[model samples]
Target chain A: MNKQLLWLPFAAFIILGLILYSGIGKDPTKLDSRLIGKAIPAFSKSLLLSDQTITEKDIKGPALINVFASWCPACYSEHPYLMELSAKEKVVIYGLNYKDDKQDALKFIDRLGNPYNMIIFDNNGRLGIDLGVYGAPETFVVDKSNTIVYRHVGEVNERVWTNIILPKMLGTEGQ
Target chain B: MKKLLVTFFILLVILPQTAFSVISVYQFDDPAKEARFNQLVNELRCPKCQNNNLADSNSELSIDLKDIIYEKVQAGESDEQILVYLKDRYGDFISYNPPVKPSTWLLWYGPFVFLLIGGFFLYRFQSSHRQDTQDQQNDEQQANSMLEQWAKEAKDQETK
Candidate 1:
């Protein structure tokens, strides 16, 4: 019995080691959204490329609301993928221009080609705060009913679209 | 040499203290509101920085969060309301003091449970050790008495 008891600490150490090992190489910055399955928060903000205003109602249908900024380098990196998605018409994509200078944002859109159907200008990141956005480029998938189904913190790439997002949208559609 | 040492100490400590005191300044209508803002920021975690709280982090996200906290404070929102608003967006991890819930039970109780289990094991081991020593002493005493008895018996036999 004493010999068996001696193994308890070893067992505990192994269990803790396994737990800590599982967390290794995982992105610590990616936080799960508390707003998943909830409706988008109410807000009306001006369009970045147009004179029109974009609101929560505009977020309806199977769509992607990507938070981006002219100042964020990651947004530039993900711009081409967004353009490809836009060209394919797989889903409607809206943009939330987070805390970017208007002239810089306009120049960025002109230089990189606009992928957003309607871009919402969040000058002070008020709406970004409402959406729980910490940094760009964060992406959200809203279902037809305007409910946010998935939120990705980093840049949306092909891997994320095919593996994480497409299946989620398909599963939602099947339901 | 002493004067030089004092000057070096002042340069290393006092001068750096003023230089590194880059705490962001914000205008508050009332001192109480400023105090509340300070407390709230310190209690909230910076989502971007991960390691630092809002007050200690100089990240852009932390600055934005601090600004939001200030706005809410200025608007006369209660601390609880501000926390709720942030938690709604950032999840429960944003708050340093997470709420007591089923998911957070392990976080709140794991250390105490570990300590309790450790203490129990320590107590059991010590008691068993003490019992083993007592048994060894008893055995020694019995052997010594047995040897003495044998010696007494031998002496009696020789006397007879």
Candidate 2:
């Protein structure tokens, strides 16, 4: 029993080492959203460059709420994929013009080719806070009931569309 | 002239401490509210920066969060309400103080369990060490009594 007990410390060290080692290559920046499986927060903001008031009711489901800003470089990187998703894939994408001015946002859309069905202007980023947005190029997949199923931070690429987003989009469509 | 320049540089460093050129400065008429605001910002972590709290983080998200906190405090919302609001948006990761839950039970109790194990080992070692010393002392006592008995017998023999 004493001999067996002597191995306990070594066993503990090994267990701890294994646990820490598993976390080595894992990205700490990727955080799961607390808002997942919950309905999108209600807000009455204006559409981008328009006087029309937009709300949670206005947002169509089986769609994406993409938070983007003109100043964010990652948004520029993910622009082509969003265009393809919108034009070819026929996926409904709503733009959230986060903390960007009307003129710059218009120019940005013009340059990138507008991929959004309709853009919601979040001048003060109040709506972005309501949606729990921390950075630009974040996308949330909304189900038919307007429940947010998944949220992806950073840029959305072809791999993300194929693996992460499409399944959620199709899953939400029948619901 | 060198002494004057040194004093000027010293004044330059000291003067900025009195006047902050920060963006998140909110004008609060109530000192209590201001204190609560300051406390909340320090306690709340910046979701973008990950490491820095809302008070110190210069990230855009941190600035926006600070603005929301200021509004919430100004609107006479309680600290708990403000915490709930932020927690709803950012999850428990926003607060430094994690809630007591099953998921975190290991985090809270693991150290105490290890401490108990260490304490048990130390106590066992102490008791065993005492036993060793006790046996040695008993042996010494037995030898001393034997020597005393021999000395008494020798004296008795001489006397007789």
lDDT of 1 by residue, A7-105 (tens): 888999999999899999998888999989999999989898778886898776688899999999999999999999989855789899999999999
Q: Which DockQ-derived CAPRI band holds candidate 2?
A: medium
DockQ for each of the predicted structures, in order?
Answer: 0.68, 0.54
Among all candidates shown, the one with the greatest lDDT: 2
Per-model lDDT:
0.89, 0.90
lDDT tens readout by residue for model 2, A1-175: 2577788889989999998999999888777798899998989998886799988998879899999999999999999999999988999999999999889999999888989989999999989988888889899999988899999998999999999999988888766
User: Which candidate leads in DockQ?
Assistant: 1
Cα lDDT tens digits, model 2, B8-47, are 9999998787665454379999999998999999999999
Candidate 1 lDDT at A87 equals 93
> Per-residue lDDT of B8-35 in model 1, one digit per residue for the tens?
9878887756854556488887989988
